[model samples]
Target: MIKKDVLFNEFLIRNATPEDAVQMEYVQQQCYPTLDPTELLNRNHFINHIKVFPEGQIVLERDGVIVGSASTFRCNFPTQESTFLESSDNLWITNAHVPDGEWMYGIDMGILPEYRGLGLSKEMYTVRQEICKELGLKGQLIAGMTIGYGKMKEKMTIQEYCYALEIKKFTDPTVTPQKKAGFRWIKPLYNHINDPEAGFACVFMYYPVDDNYKLECKL
Candidate 1:
């Protein structure tokens, strides 16, 4: 038990441990079909993350089973620029973490099928945002997903679809919920993820850890 229960009915969310890799791997495989399972983190990776910044890694537990996980690391990346991140391959290289980077890069967030649609994802993002604020991080860098684009591609251009999403006319299953949690779609990127659901591209988004949320915190 990590002291903070994060009570949500029968669910509990807490910081992850290196020992959680097995459970996290299972949840990742079950929830994230678009990602290559082989690319998923192993024990060593989880251990490294736990050592690097355990505050940024969170897991949701229900009935003594891990149902969701979120991974993040301090990274050197342009928050306001459309830089093309090639793949997840080079990003997870060991010892490549920047402990004091200006930005906190969200690496992954997933929830088991049985645990979906219960506002758990929003809870995880809230945890991440809290961690960023604690570490004095500037902003969050997420390659947002346009999950509903694949089906809509047949009826509209990618440009039109993204515009619709941007203007609140429509919402995607994944990104829209995240947007509701305060992330903004800043730009689009190529090869950000292996998923085609995003039209082979993912939106680059930025979320600030605003001090305005705290009464005594200064901007």
Candidate 2:
């Protein structure tokens, strides 16, 4: 077993290996219970994706145990098909939607329940930003999701949730926590599904991996 203290002290960020597939699969199931099994990519899928683009998938280890994970792939507007149906035809839209040579990163970041409220999430972004800089990427784009858990039932609409939370967007708030980490709101897109409460809103956010951008942990 991995030592918890050692794991938490250092930022063990690196590409996801085939060995990490099983652990990452378990983490996703535990973190997103409501996600459809079909929608969740299996271990083999992660292995394939990493084999082609190792830098795209990232995992965090506390000592030697996996505690968090995130993945980023080269993409354009609409990010992913699940978030925007048009994303499936990326080849066609690439010429029109994307600039002459600009590129975006589709990101999915999650942390184990126990490790949350810490700066791990922000650190994950920091790693991603560094990769973006190394790759000479223009911007980091993401579609944020908002699922109303049992305790969050009252905040029904996106506007209502933002007002209550005092944040500008739903997925990652536009306030201290996210903004201080070097993120900014782009625009709100359509919802992923029909159900308002359970549906996920496609809010776009971007971070430029420029020298001015600083990645810091609040907690």
Candidate 3:
């Protein structure tokens, strides 16, 4: 009679502490084979994150082992199109979280390869949405990774691909999931994730504090 999703019934989510940095780093290395620069931020970076904004760090666990992570920070999200994900990551590294800022910018989010399809990601995003309302924040600004574009680049322009996804003409492994979780595709971002195969492009997306769209991701 245990009440939980039969697939991920034992999994749980919680705030991250400085001590969890090592395991979080392990999740990153296993999830992102793209050698994302954030992978370089092991101990100090994670410690710095918790030190400055404890509420912004979180980890997903199953059977006492960390399998996924999402890192964020409060900031005055730039309206200019020039701002992107690198800035979000650097803001945390330099302790640049703007106190009382209105937006929670997602610095990173990833799940271990084996842990995918368990509804862990949308669940984690729901955590962020709850936090946003609790903190009186406006919404979330996510420079979503272009995980789908790497293969489609030869077939069409990056802009065209994102446009297709925006209108639901096509779905992406990375962006589609988030979009289904109530995030809207704003535009195709340039250089959001540092991957050459993807042409360093990603889609800029948003979720409001009052978003009513429910994800198919049942917990």
Candidate 4:
């Protein structure tokens, strides 16, 4: 276990390198049992994202050990179905489409259980937002998870087993912590289109990286 003072006093936040991918993969696997950790850690994808947005891909280290990881990048409106799901068509209409601008997207954020609840997650978000501001980003967008979707389940026309496994519940304590850091829930977005069994509901959240948004930490 990490020491109390060490958890509160100081932590290292830096851009993740290819060397950190293995440990990051471990952290993701430990944190999200239901999700496929390998998908995020695939060497090619990890390298591609890092090469594309090195500053946006970050990791938290404590005593030289990788304990948490997050990746942020510019995301445009959903012109196509989510890569996480199959099927070519899109579903559900919402006025909350992504507008033209350099909108920041928080793609993944995870921390190991032993190091959780120590305010490190929020600190990581702060760092991400700072990076966005430095890059002249306008807003940050996220597709948050949701639960209690009985009607949505029927609309997708999927079975119970697939539904239970695929449909993510809203209010994930892991991601919701971002609200305190400066995000506001925006609208609902779909993960899987037309597949009720695998379809998942997501709440979009936005946080403007404007002058009015104060930073609690020095960048």
Candidate 5:
């Protein structure tokens, strides 16, 4: 069984605790340097996340230092469709977190810039999928930032960019990686966040629990 903590390539992946809030805040700052200051989750927000839904708050550590973290909350689909600010309850993640909600909605996931491209995110996504099965929930849902759109605005519109991503015509730094990690495009979310780097747009993606891809968990 892959207990609460799992070791992979010298990295420790486990559920996050309130104490990790400081490091999480730092990591988030480095990951989204261009994002608005008001939108970033502070230390208090991280503490609230763990308090509200410990199982959905995960972090990755290397050499006993946190380098990546992901935040999620439970909610029912269709009925819970709302922008990031609304769904995340302005980063508090309390009011919107339904204890018995049917799906896990991912609000944030970030890896320090220096730690990128190590395939660590796949581990995070796997854990979320595993969490779904463990809780008997539907699956995972997210509004992914179109991080590559800002540089490509002169080339195509956000809609065209997402369509291209779906057809594999091109890839986005953020959305493509999530798609590779097993999330399928559900739609595009304009003004989802105040992210200029993403052209202020995000892509709605979903990863169902019953998908064919097998989980690598030895448990």
Candidate 6:
């Protein structure tokens, strides 16, 4: 458990390295306990991510412990539908990560359950936007989990659920926060992952660095 003073006094958000792989993996597991084992990234995956895009891997530390993390890579706007595995290069981020791509694709972000609601996610999103501006990229993109879907599946269809979210009929554990952080839903993706909680679906979202950028939505 983290001390109370540490939360208000100081917390460090810094670039992740190979050494942080184990801790990052632990946080990932904790954040998505229901995710399929194969869908979750491992320690080796984190190390590979750091090696491939060191600047895009970041971690939050409170009292020297990594309590949160965000992973990303450069990629162009998706012109076709893609699954989480395809978009993230099967979690290794080696094949699809482009050096000079137009968008900063967020692969994953996790803050320990006990450490959430502290504006940590918002801070991370801010950092990601700053990175976009610094690199002159268009903006950030993510296949956000619809974590509230499983419970609502018996009550409503996936499409209906998404519509409710759009109309603010209800809130989602994952998508709501991202929306509050300024992400806009581009579309809904089916079979995006193996999470039964999300009905194996996810929402494709984007946060443009500025208003002038437009999505070329070929779908």
- Which candidate should be chosen as best, given TM-score against the real structure? 6
TM-score of each: 0.83, 0.71, 0.86, 0.67, 0.91, 0.93
Tens digit per residue, CA lDDT, model 1, 134-195 = 78887677877667776876787766777998898978888888888788666666555566
Q: Tell me the tens digit of each residue's lDDT in model 5 across 41-102.
A: 98899999999999999999988899999999998775534677887999898998999998
Task: Note each model's CA RMSD in angstroms.
Answer: 4.6, 7.1, 5.6, 9.3, 5.0, 3.5
lDDT of 4: 0.57
Error of 6 at 58 (Å): 0.4
Off by over 4 Å in 6: 1-9
Candidate 2, 1-219: lDDT as tens digits: 111222346757777888998888777767666655544545765665566557667888876888877755665444334443334122122322333234455545777888777777777777777777666776576655544422354545555554544453444322235555666655544555333434555445678767475333111
Which stretch of 10 consecutive residues in model 4 shows the poorest summed lDDT?
86-95
lDDT by candidate, in order shown = 0.70, 0.57, 0.74, 0.57, 0.85, 0.87
Comparing 2 with 5 on lDDT, the higher-scoring candidate is 5
Q: In model 5, which runs have C-alpha deviations exceeding 4 angstroms?
A: 1-8, 212-219
Model 3 C-alpha RMSD vs. true structure (Å) is: 5.6
Better of 1 and 4 by lDDT: 1
Better of 1 and 2 by TM-score: 1
- In the range 94-175, model 3's lDDT, one tens digit per residue, is 4447878887888778889897987779988888887888899977878787787888777888789887887889788788
Error of 2 at 10 (Å): 3.5
Q: Look at candidate 1 and give me any clashing residue pairs.
A: none
Which pairs of residues collide in candidate 6? none
The TM-score, computed over Cα atoms with residue i paired to residue i, of candidate 4 is 0.67
Q: Per-residue CA lDDT of candidate 6, range 1-219, in tens?
A: 111223466787788889999999999999999999988988999999999998889888887899989999999887799888888889999988999999999989999999888878888888788888888999999989999998887888778889999999999988999999989888888888899988888888899999776776735
